[model samples]
Target: MRGGFCSGGLLLLLLIAPAGAAGTERADRLAFEVPPGMAPAAVAGDETFQGGFTCRSDAGENSAGTTACRSWISPVLPLFVFRLAWHVDSVTAERVVTGIWIGRDGASEPLQEMSGLELRMAVPIENAGFELIDMDFDGHLDMRIVAGGTAGPNVLYRNWLWSVDEERFVDSAALDEIVSPEFDPETREIVSRWRSSAAEGGVDVYAWNDGVPVIVHREVDRFDGPARCIRTFYDRIDEELRETGTGSCG
Candidate 1:
């Protein structure tokens, strides 16, 4: 599944716009093809659980010359939450989601659902923040490390932490402290952190202990008039990490 965090403006649109409308109008619709031999009921019903997590079809439509679907699951507290958004071609029936998955516990594996498929990935440490990136250059998908968090006003920092791939979030730190100082993928560290003055945004880092991923979160607030900034962290507990290391030592 190809996906990433929603930008502040987009996030607002998602929250306020009628379900499935923004997705059909703004997102490029894809041809959603069901695997051969799979039952039509597979994508039916309001919700289904794949690999121990729940997947739900939050909304759907066929009125606007497009078909759309959305799904979400709360895998962990303050980190490791999964969300999926798909816009399907009205004629071809192809689908794609702007997927979002976070593991608040380092030990828990990441849960994901995209393109009407689901899978699990090993994540050794609880993430501060993560965003979907086309890392392999396959145009398939990859995850980018943004920051880490365990708890506290997490929604405010979601965009800053999980929205950018390399430097987009880092470049805007002065505008929001919830931004991690830096992201070094080779070193697996998100360093040099500041805090938010607004009540809604912050950052946090988490790691595993005794095979359990621990969570830490930081928050910030930027009162840009009526426009408020918020960040959040979520962790997954079902998946476990296999190695030990520190992310963003600073």
Candidate 2:
């Protein structure tokens, strides 16, 4: 989900408003999923989330090693869907996907396809994969792709919000590595934690305002020694940073 793996699979719905539009149109959708695949039937996982599609796939797995792939489609403005068929090599873990044209009713064509390489998937379909969600309690859904660290500690991801005014997905700034990013529906906050060290870390609570994620609360805990440490609290809502206690055993 982060970038380059299996080459496909994720869903996102967007509602954009064009110039001089009365209010807003219906929400368009882009669905991607790794459908069930078999070993000997085909060269790639050429499956679709939508029923009855004329999609084409030129992806090959004739090279050395095993290959994995997934199917994906994105919604276009007027009346069309963009589909991609991808594959990956088993040994090298190289991945590739081809773009195919799809119609409204799920009919697709392989006209002037496009391809790329760089994918790695050894196990079965991951349950904790990418997803399309309305992070800010908005009606429109946004795209979220998760990328884990192979060796490093930082986790990276690509987030694109639905721009109703622009009629497309607006890419958000890259998010740095954090412990947990949990969103509370009742509080309407995204709870995140950043660890400075083994015993030192901070928690950042943020809220989404008009599609913008902003910090509203922060708590930093550091250990000066074993039983002598301090926990600093920061109320970002009022821009207040205070040390309520000192010389605490935590």
Candidate 3:
């Protein structure tokens, strides 16, 4: 009688297993399926791997006779896989990213999407489309998307931080607005450099304050004349940036 009872219990559990799994699959599907209008541009082709993510792309010409491409990548996160999608335009043979989508990995549906982003290089989508880093000194990896860049190697990124409480990525407008930000994980500072011309530029060092960036120091360099240049130093005092000293441009 005990053996028969055990067999009945096992059969009941097996009978309910598929229904439970189906419910979970449906919930996930409703939560993270591809956005409606973007379904037509879904990437359909062979898959490739880039920067630890599986990627795919679909290319075609738009109405303007320019090559338009849609690409997506699946990057594994701590508890989930991050799926990213973007649009690219090839004009004069230069590809530029114009839109982006953030989604869960298993399905190609986007939970968030942005369009009309600043022009950024499109190919090598791993580096240009997205970046995973520890931005807030938190051990968890954060996210960044290429916003724009100069002709030089000065690339700018739109930053997003992973929120432990929220269990999702939250946008960091302060970090995103930094000019040519370079992260120093060791020093835990954000260094930014910008130039208006070949002879005019400045460097700013910032430290995180209450999850925001506050400028701590700066060095300005510009030509005073065709041959003479000046280098000025500034330090933060009482939340103000004050010139500390000046020297010859180095």
Candidate 4:
């Protein structure tokens, strides 16, 4: 499952061990990298191998609109990263928003949205057990945009988190009003907790367990609609990591 949010202005603070710290006990720090030849997937018919459909790009009046494409690769062991681009009529080209989900192979069912806005952004996917202590302790991550465009000053977006066991999304959560959230991996009983709000200004916290997110600690945040919190947990059934083929982004 995935945790945390990624945006242009959010400050991501990862806990790291001091210069010469020892093994395991030493604090684990967050790291990211982009491997060579990593590029967006090629558009085929109506689908892109990276899990994008109805993908199209527009370059205004300058050029013919092209297809939006994406590619995913694991730059680090167990951490998958992706890069995406939309070729709208050749001249009008842009990258997909940076936090959208592209594909999850044998991991979990893809998080689907009703809006046509593609869930093809790139974000870090780490194994559960990491904790993000808010530096401000406001119990939430800093303000950031997860997806969607802005209307004047306020932006519209959707935030999602899932707990996966094997290849199923056992639990999930989507928010239209939440700005940011932190994941606490250190908590033994409760693996992670998400703090969010409603359009009417109601705030709530949804909690879940580590390995068995869907089975245990199934709770929802009651604000307006059906409790909108989805949770899923992962177990270390397969410890070995495998790499997948690279996509050509022409």
Q: Which prediction has the highest TM-score against the true structure?
A: 3
In model 2, pairs of residues that clash are 2-146, 10-32, 17-164, 54-108, 66-90, 95-118, 95-119
Clashing pairs in 3: 33-109, 34-109
In candidate 1, what are the lDDT values of residues 1-250, reduced to their tens digit? 1111222301111212354766555433322333344221222332221111222233445421211222111111122334333333455443323333333323234333223221121222122123432221111122333233324323222222222233121122321333343333333333334433433333343332442223333322334456543333233335532223212111
Q: What's the lDDT of the predicted structure labeled candidate 3? A: 0.54
What's the TM-score of every candidate structure? 0.21, 0.49, 0.61, 0.25
Give lDDT per model, in order.
0.29, 0.39, 0.54, 0.25
> Per-residue error at 188 for model 2, in Å?
1.1
Predict model 2's lDDT versus the native: 0.39
CA shift of 175, model 4, Å: 4.7
Poorest lDDT segment (10 consecutive residues) of candidate 1: 1-10
Highest-scoring model, lDDT: 3
Model 2 — which ten-residue stretch has the worst lDDT? Answer: 5-14
State model 4's lDDT.
0.25
Compose the digit string of candidate 4's lDDT tens values, residues 1-250: 2222111100001011234553223222111233455433433442212211122222223321122222231111122212122212222232223222323333332332122233222222111111112212122221112343333223333432322223211212333443333333333122223333431221122344342222222222333355443322222324322222221111
| lDDT by residue (tens digit), candidate 3, 129-154 | 55665666655556776776674545
Residue 148 in model 2: shift from native, Å?
4.0
Mark the regions of model 2 whose C-alpha exceeds 4 Å error after superposition: 1-128, 150-154, 174-180, 225-229, 237-250
Q: Comparing 2 and 4 by lDDT, which wins?
A: 2
lDDT ranking from best candidate downward: 3, 2, 1, 4
